[model samples]
Target: MDIADLTPAERRVWEAFPLGEGVDFREGADDDPAAGASWGPERTVRAEVLRALLLGGPVRDDGIAGLKLWGARITGRLDLKYGTVEHSIRLRSCHFEGAPDLYGARIVALVLNDSVLPGLTAGNLRSEGVVRITCCRIRGPVRLAGAKISSGFFANGARLGSPDETPEEPVLQLNHAEVSTDVWAVGLTVHGQVRMNGATVGGQVNIENAVLSAPGGTALHAETLVVGTDLNARGIHARGRVNLSGARIPRHLSLTRSRLSNPDELALRISSCVIGELWLQEAARIEGTVNFRRAQVDLLHVPPEVWPEHVRIDGLSYRVLAPHRSAEQRLPLLERETEGYLPYSYEQLTAAYRTLGDDAAARTVQLAKLRRHRRTLPRYARLWGYVQDAAVGYGFRPMRAGGWLLLLLCTGTLAFALHHPPALKPSEAPGFNPLFYTLDLLLPIIDFGQESAFAPHGWYQWLSYLLIATGWVLATTIAAGITRSLNRQ
Candidate 1:
């Protein structure tokens, strides 16, 4: 209303305001040419100008649809703590130079684009409506403890540095808000977002947990803005380096946690706000020096949100080894969540295990899952064949032991021929060398596993040879029977 209605401290601020020569009277809908002409022809609001605006009574309805305080010198404490504005607001070019409290200030549409405000002490403020505060400065710790807004609100490219006199709380606190639409602060240099959380927003939020020092970043308790939907940011610069250490993404996208020292350099943490769908696809390269440690995605079995490919890539890319077999049997694609969710099943685990030469374990994994999810498993479960063959073969390194058996047989036969007596000599036979008959007769004994009976050794060695031959015959018969059964199927 009028300076007469204000408190004593507010009245003193009003009385001193007009006397400050450099009053940069700016209009909400127009740039202040008077603001340009006031500073001794140099076009600037000196400290005196800021002091004047600080003392001016609650900005009255000066006939304009909106008003701009420009660069007003807030020399004294200005309290508009319970004031209310009905129209839109703009603070595009202004600075704060006092302990101004707007604790309950409410406006319809407010914008604080490209502004800077520093105070003598505390920074307790509030705003409502479509607020925009891009490229501004707040040198003192700010507290907008509980505020409400109706539309989109933005404060990008803002900085938060401790003023000449510092406030004990965080540099910026937005504890809660109630916004009807989007709330964004893309490249804000906040001491943190403790102040921002005060408002309960109903739309998407874009505060990237912006800083790295004593506040900000996804560190312990002091995180940036807790967003409503699609929380996103990219090219975010942090102070002592950034950390997304334990921040959980409720939707989809998340940068592999990393250090971001600068927005203009490699240290910037890039974000792709769309965390839904849980999958980013194959050609997606994060294009930074970020290292993804252990992160996973949430996936559903149906309406498949990018499966097989995404799952395998994430699993193989990040070297997701087999987790507990129980987990593997449950959801095969767990390894792929980092990149996206995939329907990893026991079949995939089988493929992985086969590569590791763990056929038995792989078979076991498949068998366990097969009981419940046989339909989901691959058709040709190789484990069936492996169980029939591998277990029986035990330590069967065929080449060495199989070759030794053939050599022993041939050498034994030659010895037997040499040891034969004169009647057994083929040269004395009439018209028959008997070489063919000797082989024909000897082949049966070998088949019967009786080759050791003719062995240069004794009965025990003969029994061993017979046993070896019998095992072979039994194994061959079993293999043939299996082949026949499979063929029938």
Candidate 2:
């Protein structure tokens, strides 16, 4: 295409392409390449020129004078709805007075690097290649709902802010969008919500070092999102909730050193998510509750004490909890989070300890769970449970029963020796030996003719019956504990 063949508007753009080639455009200098470039006297591109460019037709000479519209101001709406654009559009450091309407358009590739745009309305856009918007400043909301990008979406170092600075409004909405590769938004800053709920990513969604602030609402709402690899948001500082509930990540969900603050509600709600590994460690400060109810993960690498005191981990399943720590250290952390007798929590902790081959720790958790459950029983049943716990630790500690038996024997022997009892039948010589008699009364199944031949009177009779009942109860408890221990082994 020769310069003589270009239209008046295209000719202006062609002339301004090489005017300031080597000048830095970031300083907002007046002599910049795009400073003199405009749509035309009418401040609008003709439909014919846009159609020709979108159709991949020749626009400039094939040499060092090739067309490169840098810092040009597209004054009017560039509506390409439902159109098929075959060529790669590279517009750098340009400005758009109005948002481009690309709804349902099929483009090859789009590179708007370092451009200042009002916003983008690209719903259902099908890009065969990458969509690059690196270092751009978007002053309004970018609606990319249901977009399908073959490569990825790169918006690194970009600043996305709402037009009215509304905290509830979404600055970058990617709901249900599907990307073949990663969604790279590293070091990005968003003044409103970055809503990516139900989006699907073939690779990782890297939002490392991003600053997201949407106070009193969700800053990052990616609920039900499906990521093929990791979803890393490390070093993020979010003022509102980071909700990732029901998300499915095959690899890991890393939020290391991130600070999330939503004091009244949940700061991180990861309920029902299926992740390979979850890392909320290394100085991650969350001001609100981090709920993990019903979530399943292979490993959870969080320092339990560092987390907020209001974590909700009921029904959360993980194969390993703090695998880097020993069982003795982890057990206390697990116990500290449990609220009363949460059976599922105890079961999960017990399974984790068992997986580490720490059977003693596992049993200890089970015993604590049982004791807590006993506290919730009815009056009579609770009394019985207390007796079982005190005697044998509910069949988990047999030595406790042995100690009870020793105490009973000492008490019964002292009582019997202090007061001698009369014989049932009068003997020729008075017999008042008490050691063998105490044993006879204490052992329920043994009788040395003291209980049958002679009987105690008044208080002594009541004491003897008490000794008999104590003997039977202690013997039965010891037998039960021994049986349970052997069976468990």
Candidate 3:
């Protein structure tokens, strides 16, 4: 690394490496990488020279030590695979001809903010400090699989994907990576899928206001992810499925005001996840099915109208639901399960209503459950179910049974009052009263003396038989309804 052998651009970097000084080659604020096309070789630095200097290649002893260059044109690949850098590296507003490869490298800190790069490969990389790539416009995939970051990974406002937007692989992937702190990717715009499967984040993963578009494929795939805190993706606009299946977030997962539209497919798949609180309020519009199958959430803040047309809640368990609504308003949510007639879902809805101390709503949900269950029964059994429903509202509405009984009594009284029955035996006959006679016939196991004293004749006998049969049927239905209700409890 002799000064005489160094080129003009290399000489500046060599001179500044000892003291960790920054060199800005741009003439103005708008002098981006595209504007560097007109710049001469004086602003170009070979990647090997920087690599040599970073690996302790004959530098004068100075107090500070880091690489901070801006607006420079990097000529070759900055390959630092399996190497250890003792100092920070900041390459802001720079243009790289090749993607930087830092696979299996251990670096103190790294910053490539506001740079236009082809791509980056930092798989298995271990960084002790923050790795910031904010506002960068990368035209290729950025892989950080198996990486371990101590501070955090910030990629705010970064645009990742190819120019043609037909990436065969994920645009940004950090599978199995461990971040001790937050992963701040707010306002990120990714054209392809962003995968973070099996990753563990000790802090929040804030991707609010981000735009993710992968029409036919998944937009965000974070399966088996474990977030120690909230995953705030509020106001995000995703055109494909945002799958968080098997994730465990111990805090809130806010999707408030987000717009997800993957028609005829899954819009948001959080199946098998264990989340603390899930916020889908503020008119979050989800077009496709939201599968919450087997997910256990502590608190849910989804409005009734925010439910998508299709949902899969086969094993969804939640402790609390916001905006406590009546069964009439919330029962439709359980009805929206694509796989119809899951008794567990109905029971879950009933339990949720009961948790809110709305016993009336809970009973209504149970009644609806019986009605739904009846649809799957045999025709004859369904007819019996209809009888029970009409008689006692399946034991949910006991007052209806009383109303029916009163109506039958009135009908019997009117018919018998107009035409009284003759006494069977004149010597032992009591006084004739049509009301008492009707009561005697209607009461199944009761006698009022008038029924036995005055025996009905002609059509009057047939009317008495009808009344007696009606009374027995009512008694049987009421008893069956009571038993069914007790069993449910």
Q: Give the per-residue Cα lDDT of candidate 1 at 84.
A: 62
Sequence-dependent TM-score of model 1? 0.47
Task: Report the CA-based lDDT of candidate 3 relative to the real structure.
Answer: 0.88
lDDT string, candidate 3, 1-489, tens digits: 577888988898887888888888877888878555466788899888888878775445655788989999898899999999987899999988889999999999989999989899999999999999899988899999999999999999999995476898999988999999999999999999999999999999999999999997899999999998999999999989999999999999999989998999999999999999999888566888899999999888888988888899999988887878778988888788899989998888888877887778888999999999999999999999999888778878876766777788898799888987888998889888888888788777778898889878898899899888877767666666678667657
TM-score head-to-head 2 vs 3, winner = 3
Which number leads on lDDT? Answer: 3
Q: Write the per-residue lDDT of candidate 1 for residues 1-489, one digit (tens) a residue.
A: 444554443344344333321224344545432233232322233333322343332344333333444543323344555656554444456544454556666555655565556532212334445666666676665554555666676766666764243346656555544566776776666553234433445656565545424322321122233345555543333442233322334563432232233222222222221123222322123322232233333421111221222222322221123232433443543433344333344455556555555555555555544443433447676555444333333222223334444454455455445553123334433332223223323343334322322332454345335545644644454455466446646
The total of clashing pairs for model 3 equals 0
**How displaced is residue 249 in candidate 3, in Å?**
0.7
- Measured over all alpha carbons after superposition, the RMSD of each candidate to the real structure, in angstroms, is 12.7, 5.2, 2.9
lDDT of all predictions: 0.42, 0.76, 0.88
For 290-339, candidate 2 gives per-residue lDDT tens digits of 78889999998887555775777888999987745554455554444435
Off by over 4 Å in 2: 1-52, 59-69, 162-164, 323-341, 420-468, 471-489
Clashing pairs in 2: none
lDDT of the structure predicted as candidate 2: 0.76
- Between prediction 2 and prediction 3, the one with superior lDDT is 3
Model 2 weakest 10-residue run by lDDT: 18-27
